[model samples]
Target: MSPAFRLGGLELQRFARARLTRAALVAVVLIPLLYSGLYLWSFWNPQGNIGNIPVALVVLDDGDLGRELADNLIDRQIFAWKETDPADAEKGVQEGTYYGSLTIPADFTANLKSPSKDGPPQPAYLQVHVDQGKSYLFETIAKAVFAEVQATVGKSAISDYLDRIFVSFGKLHDSTLKAARGADQLADGAGDARSGAGRLQDGLGTARQGTAKLSDGLRTAGTGASTLAQGLGSAKKGADDLLSGAYKLHRGAGTLTQGLVTAKDGTSKLAAGAVKLDQGAAKLAAGNAEAFQQVDRFRPVINQLADQAVPFLRSHTGDIRQLAEFVNVAASFLADCLADLPARIQADRVKADKAYKALKTYLDTHPDLDPQLRTLLEAAEKAAKRLAELADWLDALVGEHLADLKQLERDALGVARLARQLANLAPRLAGLIDQARDKFNELDNGLAKLADGAAKLHQGTGEAVKGATKLDAGMTKLVDGASKLDTGLGALVAGANKLDIGLGKLTGGANKLNAGLGQLGQGAGSLDSG
Candidate 1:
């Protein structure tokens, strides 16, 4: 250290003794300081001077997108933006009046819009026209600035397109939610429909059973009606026979009445002869004892004839009384038949009508019934209508003849009383010939009235036979119709079951659709949020 210190002090003394050396040393130090300071000052804050650089802006676009970009660049003041035409901008750049020219083409907005359309995408450009011969540094700076402008325009266009896409996603999310709600309602409705279809199937099954039973009952009723018709026919024949017998009895009673009147006249003549004979007997009492004995012998023979006649008249009276009683019974039966037949027929008619209505309702509701079934239902309805008409006819017949039937009953009772009076007088006919004649005349009148009543009863019975036959036929048709209804109901129930199954499947599908739509809505909501 001591030797270095000594050498440095000797150099300093030599420097102080020479003016040229001192001046050269000072100049060397100042030259370095000046160069360093000048270089530092020139580079300091170069970005602040960028506003002094001239840049030409040429906007030839037909839309506002290009103008918007130009306005943004001007407001930023990244460079001294000069608004000019395409020709002027080009001339300014070549003459170094502008560091560079930024040109927005006529198709700039069109190209930006193209990206949002449904065709091939196009790229939007910000054209940079720079002159390297004017100044390399300026050209470089202009290119860099134009590159930033391109980024700014690209970001603006991209951001606008992205914003529109996000808005569309938001709308889609709302629409999807509405669709999902609708699908849920549809699913619920399908489920309810499926349940209703099941209930319908059950109800159809019940109807089928009821119809089957009804068919069986109708068949049984048809058979019973046929039997009843046969009985009515036989009753009608009996009534006709009774009418013929009553006519014969009326003629016989008239003949008997005339004979009794002649007998009564002879009895009166005999009584007068007896009176004259009594006067002659007083005169010849003493001398004619032999004549008396002859009279006594003829009296016994007359008495024997009276005895025989009395017994015969009594037997005939008993036969006539029995015939009158039979007539009374027939008349009473006819009155009862007329009184009750109409109500019974009406009740049956009502039943038939009800059955027809039920079947018709089912047929109308189920239009898709089998052809054969429909035909059967139509036949049943016709049969029911015919039955009702037959009932009306029978009821009217009985009602029209009701008074006649009651009169016949009264006439039959009168004939029975006449026969009873004749029977009481038969034992005393010889003593009471006049009274017996009167009774015979009354019996003849009663018999004639009974014969007229018999004729009416016979006619009414014939009508009953015809009505019974029609009822039998109508019941047979009803039975057939009921069978057809049962079959149709079976088919309907089967179809209902199928419908229920189909509705179940539809419900499942609707539920799945609702669930999928819910997921889609959720995804759309997420996209919109992003």
Candidate 2:
């Protein structure tokens, strides 16, 4: 315990001595201070875009457009680009040797001509190498430089390829618009066509029904025509019978006219003969006047003799009685005949007067003919008076048989007049037959015209039915076209929706790029602060 106490005192004394004598603590403080001073001296004076900037241009592929793009970045004064070999270009970017580098694949020109292919595989590409976090001095400077480089290289590719894409897109847009408009138009037109077709179909159905009705009507008309033909046939038969009867009647009328002419000639001859007889009787009476006066004186003398003979013959009768008696008987018989003749003549006169009175009574009762009938009646009455005188004389002279025969002659003359009137009636009936035949012919011609008109109506109905069927077929085709137009319009709307989504994604990508650029600038700031 005594030795440990003595050693602790000595060790305390040595540690105190070493703290004053070591010298290495001063060296650690001064070295750190020197290094901090050197870093602050070189980095604290920050150079903006103008003083000094380092840029790396590593062209990894063989293309003039890539080299030109790097040169273009330099011309804008955004970076100081340095070209490195392609083999080292990517390695240099990763090791922080240069800011970035661009590489172009072969066939870049050919790929620019057309972007899409349906047949073959295509190979054309571009490569850009960049460090994730590099010095802000180079990275910040190269940002606008590399963007310009990208744009210049893209322009160097086949310009027609971009044009083709643009033109095709434009065509697609126009086609899509056309399809939309066409769909609307087709839908409207199809609807109208469908409605029209329905109406036309209904009209065609009605027309078919009407055709059926027309056929029925035609059948009925045919039946009516047949019946009318039968009626006309019967009428022709009846006409034949009537014509035969009329011909017979005409012949009878001709015979009657000839009979009337013969009768009139005989009556005229009889009248002339009666007038000559009357004149001869007048002349004989006038010329025999002296003889007639002598005869009158002789008649008195004869009457005296007859009286004288009557008395003398009665007294001297015995021998002369036989001869005188025969003479007396003959004279008495002659006197009896003379007395009965005068009485018979008186009765004939009375009968003639009664006939005239009856005829006058009949004429007065039937006097529809005025003054003309009166003139004819007066002439007839004078002729009748003469006939009555003649009848009286004849009745006194002729026997009863001859008087009855003369009365029959008057009845026969009346029968001839009645026959003449009947003959005239037959000619009038023949004229009626001619008029009836003409009327029947007109009826037959009118029925023929009606039959022709019905045939024309049937032909017109058939044409109308065929035209309606064609119209219905055309309208159905228009309705089908609308569906194709609607499908095209839907695809156009989908393309426009994709374009909007891409634009939104592009905006988000641009915001992320801005943040990355800020981080690179922060890493570069460490060269001064750290």
Candidate 3:
């Protein structure tokens, strides 16, 4: 302790001896207090330093928004705001009277509120002019306060923009919702329209098929009409020929009637003369020979007439049979054509209706089809309906003609049977005529033999009387045969006249049928075109 004390005392005395060292030590101790006091004296409280900053406010903007910002900056007490004009504010900053100056542009509010995504490039700013002559701390603090106020105004402007944007977005949302609803309605309408269009298309398809069928029917009808026209023409010509033949037959019948009367008179005279021959033997031989010659000559004429009549009847029978067969075949074909037409039309209509329903359902689900397409679809629907109607009408027409066709078929069958019977009887009638001719020849030969017997038996009167009686019986038979021939000829002429009248009616009916077919064809063509 003694040694340390002695060293400490010596060090103290040495420190005291060096005045400059002693002064330096005292200065070091006091300098800290001075520095602390100087700094602390200027800032007695933290709150006092806030408004102590001298800042100039150059209110260049005359609007309320800028004026409000100025008031807010001053109210914050961050700076000692000195309201001044722009010239004074700039002079104050340059003269170091202000730490910084804030200048608000005249169009501050307008600039602040103008919103752009790219940039509010020339944004409403607090134009700050900092005094370089001020302390770095003062300048830094002033600039920081200015930056905070600028940010505050910027935040306010951005907030206002955001509020307006939100409001606009709200209105847009309502408008968009309404537009969406309208679009939905439009889509629904379009769907309905598309469905209609599909239905129309299906109808059109059905119509097309119907028209095609109608066209085919028209063609067949036309062909049938043409054939009928030809048949009518042929029938007319045949009727004319028949009428002429009937007239000729009537004339021939009249001639045959006169000849029959003459033959009958001659036969009666021969019979009387034969009776007289019994009384006069020489006269009986002459009369028997003359009667034989007359009989032989009449036989040849009868054979010729029979041959002609048989051939003519056969030819007419064949023609009638052919006509009947043709009519029967054609009627059957026509019946087949009409039989299924109504069913086919109904089936097609059902298919078209089904297609329309399916298409309508599809369109209901998807309503965004083009408007022009919808219109076309509607038109198609109408066309299909019309086609269906046309088909129905055509079916009705066919039905109307069906009964007539059936009647025709019945008539044809009758004609065919009648023709067949006539055809069969024609040959037999000719054979009967040949038998009659042979009988006549035998009679002639017997008369000649009797005449020879009469001449030889001039002395035997009883045998001559028997021969005369046989000759008189033969003459009576000849008169009866001639009368029958005249009656048959008259009947033939009457039958021919009836046939001509029937053929004339048939031709007229055929002409009417042809006209009806033509009209039907025209209607079919019109329907097809439509």
Candidate 4:
């Protein structure tokens, strides 16, 4: 330290003796102070001077969000923010007119609005264009400023999106409350409906029971209708037989009337013959008396005459007896014919009337009977009435004339007995002959009256045949109608069975619907609680 100090003093004595060297030493010392002071002065308020840094702001977005971001950067004086297009901002950064440029893309606002929850998030970008070739500090400062701008945009966009999300949550909460209230009401309605469905199912069960009874009743009615149809068929057969009998009776009455007419003519001729015989008998008796008085003169002649006359008288008496027997037989035949004819007709009339009444009653009970069937019934009724009237007429006629027919038979027998007595007694012959002639005339009158009555009866019987024929056709139609009614009842029973089956299926569906509604109500209750 002593030698070094002695050498530094010699150098300082030399620098003191030279003016140039002294001046050089002072300059070197001042150069360090000046350089240090200038450096310190340059870095003193760099942050404060940040506003002087030229930067470009390019807002290409179509929405207000981009413009609002640009305006905020300018107001904050974070950089020398300039409103410019993308080309101008790029040109300014390259020409050193701007340190860097910040660009908001055309889709910035749109991209920010598209949340990740909606779909894939599209990130909004703020692009920074800096010229690091011009100055590294400028690139660094631009990057820092862009970072701040990014944070401001993120904060604003995120806050707005979060506000929107909160509002949506509020709306969702209100909608959930309304839905819960509606679900509660629906549950109540479903409960009421379930009860109603139960009641409906019970009612349907009752209806099914009633329908079963109805079907059974219809089946019973169908059986009864079948029986009725069978009865009608039998009735038709009876009617056909009645018509046949009426035709036969009509033909028989016509034959009997003609026979009575022939007998009446024969009786008149026999009466004339009997009168002539009586006159002859009186003459012969008178002649015999005279002959006896002259017997002595003409005894041989008297004997010859007496033998011929006796033979002739015997032959005439035999012929007269045969004629009287014929008259008695004819009267008996007439009496037998009238005896039961009225009774038979009366019985048939009653039967026909009964059948007609039954048809009418059936028609009255069944108002919906086919029109054609009704017409047939009406025709049958008319025919029955005609038959009844004819029966009544015959009954009245027989009642009025039956006694006269019996008296005619007795008188004919009496005439036959008188004729037999006349053959033995010639003296009584004339008186008996007069009585026989008178009886024959009375018998002839009775036979003529009977023939007239017989003609009327034949006419009445012909009409009865027509009426009976009509009744037969009508009964056949009635049988067919009854069969149709039975068939219709069977169809109705089948339809009722189908309806009962349908109701059972409907009840099952209602039960399923009630269970589904119960599940829906429970789910809604959980949602409301949440």
Q: Identify the candidate with maximal lDDT.
A: 3
In candidate 3 the C-alpha lDDT for residue 62 amounts to 55
Note the Cα lDDT for every prediction shown: 0.56, 0.46, 0.59, 0.55
TM-score of 2: 0.21
Error of 4 at 157 (Å): 8.0
What does candidate 4's lDDT look like per residue over 1-530, in tens digits?
69999987786686567664455455545544554454455446646777788888888887777777777677777677888886687557655688667776565666557434312233354555555444424434644675667556556644454222210000001233344455555545654553344244346456656655655555555555555545554554554345335433433443344444455455555555555554555555455444444543444454455555555545576665566566556655655555556677678778877877787788789889789988998788778777777777777877788787567656755655554454346444445545555555555555555555555555555555555555545554544554444344334433433333233223323333444444544554443343
Candidate 1 residue pairs in backbone clash: none
Model 1: CA > 4 A from native: 1-45, 115-120, 138-143, 150-158, 161-530
**Residue-wise C-alpha lDDT for candidate 3, range 73-143, written one tens digit per residue:** 77676678899986687557545687666676565665445433322122343445554323334434544
Model 3 C-alpha lDDT versus the unseen true structure: 0.59
Per-residue lDDT over 395-473 for candidate 1, one digit per residue giving the tens place of the 0 to 100 score: 6876788787567656755655665565555455545644454455555555555555555555555555555555555
Report residue 105 deviation for candidate 4 (angstroms).
Answer: 2.5
Give TM per candidate.
0.23, 0.21, 0.26, 0.25
Ranking by lDDT: 3, 1, 4, 2
Task: Point out the worst 10-residue segment of candidate 4 by lDDT.
Answer: 164-173
Q: Tally clashing residue pairs in candidate 2.
A: 0
> Candidate 3 vs candidate 4: which has greater lDDT?
3
Clashes of 3: 5
Which 10-residue window in model 3 sums to the lowest lDDT? 164-173
Model 4, residue 342: distance off in Å is 24
